[model samples]
Target: MVTNEQRESAFLWTLDLLNEGVVALPLVSQDFSPEDWAFVFEGLPQDLRFSLWKALTEDKKSSILAAMRDDSREQLISLLSNQNLEDVALASSTEQLVEILDVLPKRVVNGLIKKLSPADTEELEDALNYSEEQLGRYVNHDVYSVNKSASVGEALAELKLEDLPVYTDSILVVDDSDHYLGQIDIKLLINSPKDTNVLQLAEFSDHVLAADMTLFDASESVKNCGRSMLPVLDKSGRLLGRFTIKDAIDVYQEYYEEQLSHMGRVSDEDLFAPVFTSARRRASWLGINLITAFAASFVIGIFEEVVVQVVALAVLMPIVASMGGITGSQTLTLTIRGLATGQLASSNLKALGNKEVRVAFLNGILWALVVSAITSVWFDNPWLSVIIAIALIVNMLIAALSGIFIPVLLDRMGIDPALAGSVILTTITDVVGFFVFLGSASLLLI
Candidate 1:
């Protein structure tokens, strides 16, 4: 068995190979995890990284490209020469090519498109015409679709004339005008008699996607249908292309990454990006957070007179605010997740609000009793305990309501709920918690 020291030595040697611009594919294939590959790629110098990438097989290249974050992919693409860029673009699938093009400058993208064949150029131009969030931008244009009136024999003959599209499990059926009809599973087609009409064996589905549909909506359709591929249609019902399960997964991953970046208040940046580039990307949100923090502090400034009158109010004020902030954060996270996953809708808003309020009331009563007992025993003051307990219950209930509404309202305003929701929720909780606790103390205790 290899000792720990020996294992460390082997890992270091592998990393050294990557640094020296050596082809380590055989070793990487046998020993490295996907994460290990990512680590090595990240550690390599720019020139060496490009060399190693160029040496990878098409499948390995695709895997690595998919595994990389947007920033890393963009950095690598920027480092390539025009010829190298053209070669890489030509070698990739329609989906992969779109991803590569997304990071490049518009001029570079146009130049690369010019290098493509006439058919590929047209398809790429079509994809470029759609907005980034639209399904048309990512659909695979290189798909196999036969006329619906064709016989199974004719379909088989067509398949022999050209290679099948990648990741295709079924042949799409279309009309003379290129309107989508349905799909025929290749296995079923193979089993049926050759003279049979293709339409007779076609599996009609109502789950066709529209080219202008948002990626999120298209992914939902793909998931609900559970098909290997879903055909895309234009506004006039003409066939545009097809979206595969792989494409749907890519969309989901992109959406998830965007949400994560938004929550951190940072755009996705390369791990090894230039220091200033990374800082600039983060500075905007940090500035916004600073402003919101001041807003919370201003609310606390208003309660100074009450705090001076009763020292206990100052000591216990944070407890009320902290608890409210935590409770609101829980609700905020859940609501944002529900929105992202399409699990929550406007139709359920009233019902969801009522449910959350009920939960908050129950939890507030239980926790408030515990805190009140502790405060009474410590301070020898029942009235103070009762006041704090009431404050807790009130703040918690408001926190729950604010948490549910803030994200939904922001979403309707075309703002990202995950990015702004936490900040807004914190401000509300702090202001309300401080005002309720201090206002009550000024009236009763002070």
Candidate 2:
């Protein structure tokens, strides 16, 4: 088997061939997987990518396209003929086909829709009816099964006539109505009495994903249930398809990518996209940050006289605000992670919030004392030292509570917590920390 590092090297080697104006297709049989080809395809500059793509056979194209990211695949997809597009759709999962169709021209979609068999059309339409996050959208239709009442020898004979499905740990056993009942392992089927019923030899399992279950839930279930794949069923328990380990892995990668994008308040865009396009996508977030910065500056302006009376306040204020910002970010990260994993439920939410506040309060008291000792020795003003200590404790308490509440409130209002939570937390901590420290000095020293 090719290791990931070797697979990565394959793309570099193939790109070397391309730069020399050499044909790239001959490299397909050189132990590099379609995934490696996908990397090479995506790595190529857009102008040169399509020329190499046209050289590949449809089978090669289909496999490589399956492994490529959506943006890169769509670039080549637009150049494919109707027959090639049809073949791609047939090879894709329900959700993938729906997304592919979304990008096609209206005329092309109409033509493509007609070419699909009635069953294929229904499945595609059915998949589209669910939310993108739901399992119904991502179901793999390439499933193999056997009737539960069939004899073991007959079932074994049927397996010999056809190829096994993807992630075929066992032959799923179903009834005449296509209601999933159990599974018979290939080992058991071969070793069982020839005349024994498949149902008698089947391993019963309730592990399944409902069509409406979110992909994240399905991923967690797949891990916890100790199964690499599970039967996907409708509300009526009729087997719709299979949710395999590959699907679970896709869900994980997608969630990680989404969170990374949301953290920067930026679109999940291609790296080699136009400079203007990437700039336009990022500029809006920068503008929002500027607005918040002005708000923070406005707070400092309110304490203009407080700072002039004691220039040390200017030097020490940042120390207070920086501490609060770091502390709040730590809490916010935890809250967002919990929400993503479905771990922050009603029963545990209040406890988590309280525990965070207690942790913050204790750390505040401990660190404030340490800062006060330093301030007393450096400035030789006990009053300034006391004021800074009080300010630290107050700001930290506020930071902790804001960290917990901000994410919960944003989620309730249908906004992504990871996207805006850090921005909002930073603004609050800066403004509040500055206000508390300077306000105490004005009241006590002025």
Candidate 3:
């Protein structure tokens, strides 16, 4: 198996070539990792993407389809034969099928659902009703379950006749009405008396997931819970499906990628997506940033007269603004991390904010002294040094506070902090740093 580091290296190297329209199999091995193949799909054009998809085996096609972004998958799926489409629907897991269905034409989706087995058709329908952000979409419906009242021997006999699902550590025990009771491990079943009631030896757990639980909470629960698989129950505690470690990992990976998209404003469509469509998506954010940029510029314009009078202020303006932006950005990054990892919250928010402010204050004073000393010697103006030093300390202190609060405010409002926070922080730091530095110079230096 290829290691993760090696896979990333291959991805990076291959991506460079892909950007230039080369090695795209102008695609690759039918055995390529789903992620790598998805990358290949992203790098190739529409015609070649379909051609490559046709060449891969059915199983490979099923995986790559799930790995693809919704827009790209919809485009590629439009070109598939009805027989091939049914193959994909049948081959996919409940979660994968739900995602695939999300992007398909409604008529296509209806046709595909009709082709599924009755049981699968029901499972997929149940999953389709869930929000993509909920655990229902990601839960696996192929659970191995047994009745709690059944004898161990009876359960063992039935288990032998079925192919176990992946990561089947334990068989879920249920009541006659199909409500979840507990879990009976295979080892326990094998060693116990044949006549023993399955529930007599089962591990009753308080750690079951409700189908309506949010995906973020589900992922966190699956990660922290020691069990390799946890049962998904409906509101009535009936076993609906199971959330596995593998499922948690996939969710985490997807979430990490989503965060990356927010942080970098990267579009879901890969580098090879339609030019104008990609451009249009990017233009929206860049335009918001432009508005913020103008606000910072307006502050600089307010100090235009001060800058003209004190030539030294013009030279030293960027130094204070740059320092504030850098320091504020560092604080912003840490605050966002704490929020994502479930560390920082409103109750303890003040403590972290104070800690960062103190740290920034000390560092600010130190850097200010250093900059002032340089300004004194380089420009031979002591008052000019004093003005910049005051501006630096004030700007950095505010920068630290802004860093802590901005993300919190954005999060509370349901805006993605990673996407909009940086722009807003940069603008605040620039506007404040310039306003204070030049404002002081106007009153003192001139």
Candidate 4:
């Protein structure tokens, strides 16, 4: 079997027309990387750049935009005529268009903005209105919706219309008031009698999401139900638009990137932001984290006497604290993930929490035995082992409880579990774990 690399080579070979020898287009196209494209855009004659831009397919053009550097994107955008820009804009999603807009000159963005249809422009504006993390920021309003009374043939005609988005999966069916009726699978359209009404052909078994549902909520529904797309509905039951799994995937990727940056204590910054602009963005979040860490340190200060008196307490404090923190983090991570994925809900919360409690106990026992043995051997004191063992068990139990409680509480308080969760979990485990361990040693070992 050919490897992916080999398959890509063959695929490139098939696009040989896109790489003719004259003008050395083959050499230029074959070795094209995003960075290379940026360089090529910088060096090429204006006329040549326009010629190459016109020659590329929409898919290829989108790929080139995806790869192009920030500054280069503006030049490329300027090179494309209004018609070309509109095509590229429509081919891309609202998020992608916004990203390109951020880099392109305001005039170019305005020009392209004007070229998009009223509906497409509405999508861009709606997505832009919300901060990137909100539910509205990632939705695709270009979703296909049809009236229930239309025939399958009519639905196909609507789909075939150049202005409407081409979708291969399903078309949302709405009543006269645009209230969601159901969904008609495109596959059913293929096999149905052309005269069949769309309502008759539609599957009423749609899982509609609310318009204001978070990106997390949207992603969870898509993941659990395994849908290509889900219809978003208003409280009044009006059909909003289709939420594609693709959009959710894009949101997940963006969030994961943000999380990775935050893990390094950096704020989310625009890729094209100026150095000072990036620094300004980074500082605020880091400052917040610094303040939080100082608070944790202050809690540690209250027990400093305990720590100094029992040097062994200092030595072993982090062991118990780290264990609780890590275990609590594990629970917090899983619980937040479950909530995000819609696996843990009020109905099943008890069962899920109980399972986590059992898991914590089992892990606690195993680690407790290990710590007890190490303490007994190293200190040559069986009693030290007993204190450490009891501390571990107590800390682990608290870790398990805090893990579930913190996220659930934050969720109820309308706080983002992603942003505030780890902080809360760390604080709880640290303060409680240290107090439990050192207090145990003070009360029992002494």
Candidate 5:
């Protein structure tokens, strides 16, 4: 068995070679796991990593890339040589190719497109024509579609001679004009008599994905269909390509990472991007937050007299705002998730809002009692306890309403809900929480 010492020694040796400008291709391919390779690549200087990456064969590079996560692959692509980039684009599936293209500059993309074969160029052009978030951008243009009149034997003969596309599970059935008719499962074709026509066994009435469908909607189609591949058709019912399960998964992962970055108020910057660049990207959101914070401070300033009169009010007011912020955040997260997954739509908004209000009402009653009891015992002031309890209930109700509406409004305004929703939600919760508590105290306690 390999000991920790042995692993460390090997890793260090690899690091030395990488630092010294040695490619170490054999050692990398034979000795290192994909994880090990990624770790080593991450440690090397950017220039040196590019040099080492250039030294590897195309197949080796593809294997390493396949092993890495999307973010890691993106970083590597950013630093790759033009020739290396061409190789990857040529070899990658349409989905992977689109991902690489998405991060590249227009000039570089145009340059790379010139290097590809006519067939690849056509496929890439089709993908490029669609919006970045559309399923058309990720469709596998290399799909095989047989005419409905073709026999199983003819289909088998075609598969034997043609270069099969990746993720091939079913042969798409099309009409004489190449319009999509249905699909024939490979297994069914293989088991059927050679003389049997494809139309006899075709699943003619099945779910077909529209090429113009958004990636989010396409993913939902993929989930509901539960098939290995779904035929993608254009507006005219022509079979353009296929959207494989693997492509659907890649779309899901890309959207997931994008949403996570949006939620964090970052633009999915490369992990090794310059410190200044990363800082600049975050500064905008931080600036917005600062303004919101000032707004909250201004509300507190309005009740300065009450705070001074009852020093305990200052100490306890933060608890009310903090609870509201946390409660609103929970609702915001759920609403954003529902929207992202296509589960929540405008039609369902009324029902969802009512459900959240009911939930908030129940939680408000229970938690208000708990806080009121604690405050009464701590300060030995029943009136102060009652005021805080009322404030808590009001804030909780407002928090729930704000959480649901903020994202919906942002989405309607064409702003990214995930990115802007939390900031607005926090502002609403803090301002309202402070206003209700301090305003109540000012009138009642004073």
Candidate 6:
């Protein structure tokens, strides 16, 4: 409920009071509120601030650090000794650990791995290495699991006896080899007869996903299956971990980030990453686009002579090319989306292509009629209208074919259709539209 400005003023006032020798700073530090701590961290010199950061109670330190920027997080980590870092990490929750690691430099990340206890490091490492779009990234390793043969009484006794994690609610049932058998909801486990086997009351088969499955796919499965936590398994069907709703949400966020990056022609790097590192990561893709653009320009240069002879031909040429390019892009976009979703397949390609071509043809005919009318009115020549109409029809058909086929061909050739499809589509539409329209105009109109 405390505002940032109030927090800041308290921090600066505390510093002023400390400088005045009004009280012992360390004892004063002990009484400092979380908001007051946030203000102090933000107001202090970098070195002294991080020293205080390293000295705070683990929970307070985590809460304070969470409010700080990546630079501050990095500064704190840099100030810590290996032993100090290990102690700080051990006392932190999984959420806090992820937050710290998300901002830490890769070198600092590598160091933290060494600092953690072997068991803790292994658990953290698994989550760290998981694909950003995967359920593994969000799945907590702290879930409780029991054997399928365990009775409800046994499950309850286990829950009461063990130092169970705070967040665990349902006790998962697993085979001897740790394959997911089912999961007993704590409420069901409590209300059922003590003699009932845990497996009898649990729902398992319908709430599981593969380890390598994308978070997007897992989220849809979770929505359809109606469960809070879905078990993740290996190819051998051994239980690996459980993907929670939180993990599904994280995956969706990662996808959204990737989409935003793609729109800006940037590589999907972490937002918390260093600016120079992200710039270096994006340069290669931008370079590739640059090269492709020049290649397209070179193709246009081949017909420069025709452009120089008739200025209007050059002016009107881009109109036909742009229309065809737009048509091709619309078709290509749909095709790629369908292919990614596994909707467009060999069995349906014929029908899908036919539908697209028919749509393109109808669209093309409508535009061609409009352009022909314009040509007749503008040039006062019916022959020019006829030539433009013929060119329009031919270019539209070519655009339709190029849009549908190029990406399919690229997909078959094991290339990323989304990456290369647009450039190739534009090239085809441009070259074909220009040749058809301009060449026709030269013979028929000029």
TM-score of every model versus the real structure: 0.58, 0.63, 0.61, 0.45, 0.57, 0.46
| lDDT (0 to 1) per candidate | 0.70, 0.71, 0.73, 0.64, 0.69, 0.63
lDDT of 1 by residue, 1-446 (tens): 33334434444554467655466654434454433454445444345567777766655564455456677777777777766666566676666677767666677677776668887777777788899889998777778999988999989988889998777888988889988788889999988899999989887778789999999899888888867778999888888898888777867876885776555344454434443544455444433443454355446646655665376566677777776776666567657755664435553455557655765676677667877887687567788788888888899889989988999999999999888998998899889988988888778876
Worst 10-residue lDDT window for candidate 2 reads 266-275
Pairs that collide, model 2: none
Worst 10 residues of 6 by lDDT: 266-275
lDDT of 2 by residue, 1-446 (tens): 55655654555555556656775654434665665676666555555576788777665655677666666676667667777677766665555566666666676677778777898888988788788779888788788888887999898898899998767777788999989888777777888999999999878777878999999999989878876688899888888888888778867986885676465343344323333443454445433543454355456646655665477677577667866775676567667755654435443466556656766676677667877887677567898789888887888779878987899999999999989998999999999999999999999999
- RMSD in Å for all candidates: 15.0, 14.9, 14.0, 16.9, 15.1, 17.9
Cand. 6 TM to true fold: 0.46
Q: Score residue 49 of candidate 2 by CA lDDT.
A: 70
Give per-residue CA lDDT, model 5, range 293-347, as digits (tens).
Answer: 4365456656655654477676567667766665566567657754654435554
Question: What is the clash count for each candidate, in the order shown?
Answer: 0, 0, 1, 0, 0, 0
Candidate 3 per-residue lDDT over residues 352-403, each given as its tens digit: 6656677667767767787788778866779988998999899988988998
Error of 2 at 71 (Å): 3.5
* Candidate 3, superposed: residue stretches over 4 Å from native: 5-36, 43-47, 71-75, 78-87, 299-446
Worst 10 residues of 3 by lDDT: 22-31
Which residue pairs show collisions in model 4?
none
- Per-residue lDDT of candidate 4, residues 245-352 (tens digit): 766775676578457544533323222223343334433443344345435544555665555446656656666776776667656765675455333445345544
Better of 1 and 3 by TM-score: 3
**Superior candidate under lDDT, 3 versus 6:** 3
Question: For this target, which candidate reaches the highest lDDT against the unseen true structure?
Answer: 3
